[model samples]
Target: MDNRFEVAVSAGTMRSDSSAAVRFPHRWTPGGVTVEADFTGAHLLHLAAAGCVLNDIYREAESLGIDVSGVRVTAAGGFDTTTWQSTGIDYSVEVSSDASADKLAHLLEVVDQVAEIPQAIRAGASVRRASSC
Candidate 1:
């Protein structure tokens, strides 16, 4: 199996020489948090993975009668300074839950299994444009 997939993206704005108008599936505003990222271009990929994992955890926790109000997933990636190549990503998953230790661990395992974006990234799958006009 190739283990690869591709997708096409079309934007309404024309190619800009200096600036570009990017779009994201969801928009979030940080009221007082220091971390604020405008999901555009490559940043969207990171957001997708983090969001998927977070959603999975939240839903699973809810099913187990655990509240996930203050849960946060801090996803960070490192790039090689010389080559400017992406090295790897670190996931800092923090949650305030009342579930048992084993239940929480099980929930995390399920999160790993159901989160599609993170699974693709973990498998080292390449993302590229299928076609462009």
Candidate 2:
């Protein structure tokens, strides 16, 4: 990892209904996927996670000199309305490459470290709202 490309993230808060856009110094590439989510509000968290992972994976693959011509990621997550919680998220990645199977497998392993959201969710991080009184 290049020290100059490194970034740190901190969480912030604003009143409900107030739009506080989170900014990243780096840009995320959509990789031409047509799938999109709409009108879900905070439910968009899952979509954000999926998109972030897919973007990170594609970026990492390119950095390693792998040609990604027709790559696709199918990510889906379910929220439990009863508990207002995420049930789980699943990611299916399709890469059109001539790389060996072992190399592709290694690429997937490297992507896990590059993408943070899915790992955090998988580790069961407690995401909750904390308001000051």
Candidate 3:
């Protein structure tokens, strides 16, 4: 079976200028709640990391037969204006479960090694801009 997946979101800027407003079609929470997308690029990047970790935790917990009641992951980072790159990307995960501390720690470590967004960032994926007039 093919386990690979591709996730996509569509966004655009109102203008080509430096002050152009970025817009997204919509935002959806894991609980199936939809909200307007009014966040910056930095905010979205952090969110992606957090979301990936949370999802992976659930997956791993399920495979380990661990019942997880709740999970929260917080990711924080900043972009250096001079270098135009991200820095200090850090995160914390809080999980509510009945599993032992050692099991939980092991699960977290495994997920951190395999989660997609953080891996991509760590690998320094090349980004290229395409424009049409």
**Error in Å for residue 34 of model 2:** 3.0
Worst 10 residues of 1 by lDDT: 1-10
* Ranking of all predicted structures according to TM-score, beginning with the best and ending with the worst: 3, 2, 1
Note the residue pairs that clash in candidate 1: none
Ten-residue stretch with the least lDDT total in model 2: 1-10
Choose the strongest candidate by TM-score. Answer: 3
lDDT of model 1, residue 128: 100
Each prediction's Cα lDDT score?
0.54, 0.54, 0.61
Worst 10 residues of 3 by lDDT: 7-16
For residues 88-127, what per-residue lDDT tens digits would candidate 2 score against the true structure? 6666666666788888888888986768877777777665
- Tens digits of per-residue lDDT for model 3 on 32-133? 211122376766777677667766877788788887766656677667766657765688777777899999999999999999989998888777778867
Candidate 1 wrong stretches, greater than 4 Å: 1-35, 38-42, 81-84
Off by more than 4 A, model 3: 1-38
* Clash tally, candidates in order: 0, 0, 0
Which residue pairs show collisions in model 3? none
43 in model 3: Cα distance from truth in Å?
Answer: 0.7
> lDDT by residue for model 1 over 1-133, one digit each (tens)?
1111111121112111223433333222122112233554345555566667666776677676765444456666655555645566556566665677777788888887878888787788766999999
